[model samples]
Target: MDNNILILSEGMQTSIQDLGRKGYRAYGVPIAGAMDKYSAILANKLLNNDEKLPVMEMTYTGPKILFEDATLLVITGADMSPKINDKPIKMNVLYEVKTSDVLSFGKLKSGARTYLGVKGGFLTEKKLDSYSFYEGITSQSRVNKGDRLRIENYEAGMELYSSKIKVKRSHFEAKKLEVTKGPEFHRLTKKHREYLFSKQFKIGSLNDRMGCQLKNKFPPIKDQEIITSSTIPGTVQLTPSGKLIIMMRDCPTTGGYPRILQLTDMAINQLAQKKENDMFKFDLESSFDFLGRLVFRFKD
Candidate 1:
């Protein structure tokens, strides 16, 4: 089938992403997926597509896309001022596009990433059981200008609805990130532990998909090194120099620094929307409270 959409301008860092490649960490593969999974899932959910269906993950700026065929889609996460043929469109709402319709974005109003999900999802190349784009793992890491993105054909007569959702503003503006004690959390001195939860840490300029570094540092620990151990997304490591690193979606599978805290999945999602120099505090959750919340969620 002919490509359904043409990329006129490849935004800052547009890429294809879904839930990510699972079960490959043992082979040293990073789970390169959408930084904000919650928004991505909402995009797919509104379009009635599979939650894991690949969507276009646009960064600070957004790509200018020309639809070659009619399709249903939804925009979620960041408010980048999306428009169709120069007409402004709302985020978290279902919209229909016909052949030749041009979709573009303007100045970002909130959040760092945006998700564009079409009905039936993008028909992109899948590697390692996922369609997420990653350097060395996927053929292309990010979409380039003039790229033709293949998408499933829209059924002309399919039922469509005017659906919209109101996402909480706090989801983007909140400054507190809930975290749990990591395997090495107890190694820190009582003073250091108190300091971690007491101050707001600014995101360093080196933040990216791999991890986010905090500008504020804790006092250096006497023995900050640990034997390289299994690490996952949300792992917060403390380096010997007192630097704190919060692992993100594309972080390595293992690390040697002291893992002092782990952000909850929701906290990770919240952190994904933050940008350089954004200040946030860590709200440490007790083990008992964490388990209680988990049980309540499962029951619900």
Candidate 2:
């Protein structure tokens, strides 16, 4: 595994991410992981790697990489029009890249983030028992140009595996996100509650790994704040300024804003693929309803 990839250009925001460091939220640490868990898992699975192995989480733009050795790579999530040695290649399929092969991306066609998984996963220093990068935790928050990432067993015999496997792209297109009542869901006035469900929200341009700031056309809430309490990814808090913030995988472990709605695990995954300016509605469901849908989706 002495082979390494030299980063020629760091895209908008590229970072090594895994399933995130869990069980550290009590210490006010955020779970900084891949924004799109489904895509990360798919990329890893295609390489027969661990389901939670670290992958490159490329946002908006993708990095330019020069492989020092021939290795298998799988691209999932957003279609960034990847190319090997300047030859256009399709995504969601494993392809062998020869030594000195240059990999890069073109304009984004769909989705916001893309997952790049190497043959044996990208080797990086871990913090809090996880490889996911965080600003204050990991030594490096994001990959930069000229950085070298060691690839495990890059020169070893390539394992024989499926030549190409296609994952349905339609699963990433979601317009409605399912949510459940949060702790303060009942505290809102009747009109406010109705407005929350009936109105549409647009993903603000300021959205990032911390959370997705939503723009609402309605009036601002009357400065109703709550005592700082525990929060986690998917916690929907309504700011006094009338904006809605859907916490993401990198959001802080707690907050003081009023928690109005909480997105389900599936909803969070679906929302992660949405880019700025995308519009989506929140559909509230009961606990039983949520579990029922979850079961049916994964029954196989």
Candidate 3:
């Protein structure tokens, strides 16, 4: 049936994600977008779809899928061992499926999220200037069993397939993330600053869409009081007991804690690839110059 191109057999936390909604962060709306933008981009590239198309951003593993019609698709993210009708499927490369061929991915082998792209992209509604943020009022929620995702039918001789796509994967090995000093950097004592940088910190399990917990190896920071202020992603906020925490993609629009260090964009991307039980180090750079790059080109 051309009425639908893709069918999600299971949609646990399946939300339509785009490139995220900027400019609305000032109004307290968190910059909601794909958690693993790299994988999303890879999936789109495999299907010859737009980079901003709404794909199934599945966390952990993913639900089963059954297509009512044949279409070209790709899967990216954690190695979930996707299978079609009990037959293993190749990841990152596009595949043409027949009707009623069941597709399912096993539990997460590594990483935190997976991206699934459909031919011609997933048809979804948008708000503001984006179709990514589904936390608020949005047309699609996380994929669940028996959910039908509508897709556009293509004319003959317009099918695009890719059995080989340039898909790059992150190399995981107890990672070390380099960071720059933050706004409240001076609030720390000489001893505290040294400990904050050099000591080994442990990642706690209470991580989610908001932030993650890090156990402080050194002494605690006594009663530190700081006014609430604007915070960006990669901000490492400190708690009362000298613990470290990092803000993720869906972090609050504002936070009051002191941000001791900030991870670089590359480091954040690496952290986004990490899953539970994966630990990384926080390192320091000797010097940094913010004026090195001119980054004022804003897009809509």
TM-score of 2: 0.93
Instruction: Rank all candidate structures by their lDDT, best first, as comma-separated numbers.
Output: 1, 2, 3
**Residue range 1-300, candidate 1, lDDT tens digits:** 654899999998899999999999999999989999999999999998989999999989999999999899899998999999999999999988989999999999999989999999999989999999999998999999988989998875484898799999888887899999999988889888889989999999987889999999689877777899999999999988889999999999999999999999889988989889889999998879899888988994
Query: Model 1 Cα RMSD, Å?
Result: 1.5
Q: Which candidate leads in lDDT?
A: 1
Colliding residue pairs in candidate 3 = 9-145, 11-143, 11-144, 13-142, 14-142, 14-143, 18-132
Ranking by TM-score: 1, 2, 3
Task: Assess the local accuracy of residue 24 in candidate 3 as a C-alpha lDDT between 0 and 100.
Answer: 83
Write one digit per residue (lDDT tens) for candidate 2, span 86-126.
89988888788888999999999988899999988988888
Q: Which of candidates 1 and 2 is the stronger one according to TM-score?
A: 1
lDDT of 3 by residue, 23-121 (tens): 987788777777767777778877778887878787666777777767777888766788878888877877777767777888677677778887777
What lDDT does each candidate get? 0.92, 0.87, 0.71
Weakest 10 consecutive residues, lDDT, candidate 2? 154-163
Error of 2 at 233 (Å): 0.9
Query: Poorest 10 consecutive residues of model 3 by lDDT?
Result: 291-300
